[model samples]
Target: MHESFRLRVVETKMSKMSKEMIHLLGNYGHIGFTFVAAIFIGMGGGIYLDQKVFDGRTAPWFTFIGLAFGIAAGFKSLFDIIKHQNKEFEDKD
Candidate 1:
């Protein structure tokens, strides 16, 4: 009976660890995707505006602005996620 209980406890711990690992990995994946998507979307919009609306008159200016906005957005999202995660950990503790 004692042996069985020990085995069960070990199994439970392993499962919990695996679940935590998966959750952490998912968060990382989400962070990466959010960052890249924001950058691409911003740059793409800028390119479209410069080309379609301004007819290339704006040239690289709009592109640069869009890129800067994208980078800022990405960093913001990253910080927000980190903050949220920290809050969650604190709450758990």
Candidate 2:
């Protein structure tokens, strides 16, 4: 008598996620994580600039320019993300 055990190499298909889905999820996750990270970084930078350039030093009224630029960049990134999401949805449809 020969006895054999069924080996599951790929597990159950129902429990596995597609590579595309995983990749998309990873992209969105990184975007969200980076957005959060950039917020913290921007806040730190803004505070540093406020203290070092605007509060303590007698400089031009351009100290907050960098902060404004950083905020604009963040908003631009958000706009790009929304555009990309819309394009993806259109493509899927």
Candidate 3:
């Protein structure tokens, strides 16, 4: 009976830890996806403007601007996620 009780307790703890780990992984995946998505969207917009609107006259200039914007947007998203996570942790405490 004593051994069985201890085994059950250990199993419960392992299950809980596994769930938490999965949740953490999901959060990280979301953050990475959002960051990359923002960058790609920004770059795509810039490309559209340069090629379609300017007829390629703007060429690399618009592309560079767009790339810069994309990078900035990515960083902004990363920071925002970090802040949100920090807030959640604080609330839990």
**Among all windows of ten consecutive residues in candidate 1, which has the lowest summed lDDT?**
20-29
TM-score of 3: 0.76
Per-residue accuracy of model 1 over 1-93 as CA lDDT, tens digit each? 999999999999998889788878876769989999999999999999899999999999999999999999999999999998899789989
User: Could you tell me how far off, in angstroms, the CA of residue 90 lies in candidate 3 after the best superposition?
Assistant: 0.2
Colliding pairs, model 3: none
lDDT tens digits by residue: candidate 3, 13-67: 9988897788677667788788889889889989999999999998988888888
Candidate 2 Cα deviation (angstroms), residue 13: 3.1
Error of 2 at 48 (Å): 12
Selected candidate, larger TM-score, 1 vs 2: 1
Ranking by TM-score: 1, 3, 2
* TM agreement with the true structure for every prediction: 0.79, 0.49, 0.76
State how far residue 58 of model 1 sits from its true place (Å). Answer: 1.2
Better of 1 and 3 by lDDT: 1
The local distance difference test score of each candidate is 0.92, 0.62, 0.87
Predicted model with the maximum lDDT: 1
**Candidate 2 to truth, TM:** 0.49
